[model samples]
Target: MRILQPHTRPADEAAARRIQDELRARAEPFGPGPERVRTIAGVDVAYAGAAGAADDQLAAAIVVLDAFTLEVVDSAVAVGRAEFPYVPGLFAFRELPTVLDALERLDTVPDLVLCDGHGVAHPRRFGLACHLGVLTGLPTAGVGKTRLVGEHAEPGAAPGDGADLVHEGEVVGRVLRTQRGVKPVYVSAGHRIGLDAACRHVLATAPRYRLPETTRQADALCRQALREAGTESGSPALS
Candidate 1:
């Protein structure tokens, strides 16, 4: 996929923030996205070691699945050394290059992308999900394992129960219970999707686990990619 807005990689945190602020406006964070979703892509990144280490290699994976069946249809992985330092609210800069590379390698572009991170449920309201959506103009949502910035009551102990994740007096996402008694996952609109639809998609995707199938599959694939990288080199990526 050709990037329409090719930009120089930022050199510092300040530059990264400016980029985020500028691109945040381009993200369409409140649409229904595709009406009949057929395929959903799950994206995740794995670190070779500690995020700040010199040998900090990164593996980005994209797994495209049939939305109804939740079977993997296509997949891709990009492996490279980390190019940026770990900065809170600026992680997109670190993972995006490889993510884009992996996306480009995919045989198909999915109708929706389910990211293993936050979207509008972020301090800047432009997490990895938002960044990827804005960059690719794809419908995307974030399914975070933990809240990045929000406060909310615990949801009911039933599958599909949810509570609003409010941040700064605004509903930024949903704390959704995909299983009857498991902990909830945070769901947020990335781009071209609304909070309600994002939550629905989450529940549908996470039929049998705390995390969505997209995240679970992509996470496993990226971790495997990292392990493969370790085998190619004498030193392991993670200690």
Candidate 2:
């Protein structure tokens, strides 16, 4: 898989915020993606230390699945130390370097990417998925287990039920219930995709579990990769 590099990694959180604002402006939050996604990849990261700590070792994984079957097609992993301190709204800075390394190791890029974090749902409207989508120029969306910032009522108990996640008078994402009676996951546009399409993609990828298959598979793979790299079982980190 080939990646188109964006600007160099920022030197600090302030720089990262500036970069995010700049790139967020360039990101097209509304556009059509692959109409028929043949393959979709899930990207995630696991950490061996405290969140955002520079000494925190990181393991990033990319798991590609056949969109039709939801079976693993290909996978890649990368391990390294965190480059930046964990900042509240700039989680991308801590994870993206290793994630990019993992993506580059893959045999082919997927038609779409599902990230384990927020997208426009973030404070700066530039979450990990947004950052990755812009950098890779791929169709991407985020499926986050928790809301980073927003206010919403619980969606209905049935599958596919959703509510708007509003912040600052803008609907940044949706609170989608993937499975009946299960906790909802937050869905948001990353880049080159609209919120409605993003929700549909998330539903398509999440068949049985509360989380999407892509996210579950990628999360497991990253944890395993971290252990294989001689680290103990580490806690999962927001993408």
Candidate 3:
């Protein structure tokens, strides 16, 4: 995996925000993404210390799955200290370095990448997913457990039902029901993908659960990696 490392690591909140502002213009939130995605990758991060701690031991995990069967095909994990301070809207700065490292370790180049965060539905219209996609040039979308910035009526009870998520008078994403009677997930185009296609992928991948298997697996893997790192370092287990 040849991952592009273009942006220099930002040293402060101002620099991080500047990077976001510069790269955000390159994000293609609506596009002709892969029509037949054979594999999908999910990425997530977990921390072993308290939030915003500079010394927080964190782990990032990337899990690739066969889109059709939803079986794990490839996976990787990277454990490291948080490089940047936690900022509410600039979370990518804290997790992206490790996430990219994990992604670079993967053998399979996924046709689509799903993130456990927001995409265009963000305060700056550039969330973790968008940042990753712009940097990797991969078709990506965000399957957020909660809304980052948007307002929408509840989707219907049936699976696949969705409603537009509007923010700042623009449609940024969708509130989609992946499972009947389950809380909807926020679906947004990260890059090289459209909102409709992103929602379809979410529904297809989340056949049985509220969240896509990609997200669930990656989330579990990152947490496990974080715990193991903490144990090896003689630190207390993460709560």
User: What C-alpha lDDT does candidate 2 achieve relative to the native structure?
Assistant: 0.88
lDDT of 2 by residue, 58-175 (tens): 8999999999899999999999988878877988888899999999899987999999998899998999889999999998898899989989988999989999999999999999
Model with the higher lDDT, candidate 1 or 3: 3
- Model 2 per-residue lDDT at 160: 95
* lDDT score for candidate 1 against the true structure: 0.87
Give per-candidate clash totals: 2, 1, 0
Q: Which order, best to worst by lDDT? A: 3, 2, 1
Give the lowest summed-lDDT range of ten residues in model 1: 1-10
Candidate 1 Cα deviation (angstroms), residue 66: 0.2
Residue-by-residue lDDT tens digits, candidate 3, 38-133: 999989888886769766778999999999999999999999878888777888888888888898899889999999898999999999899999
Query: All models: lDDT?
Result: 0.87, 0.88, 0.89
Q: Which stretches of candidate 3 lie over 4 Å from their true place?
A: 233-239
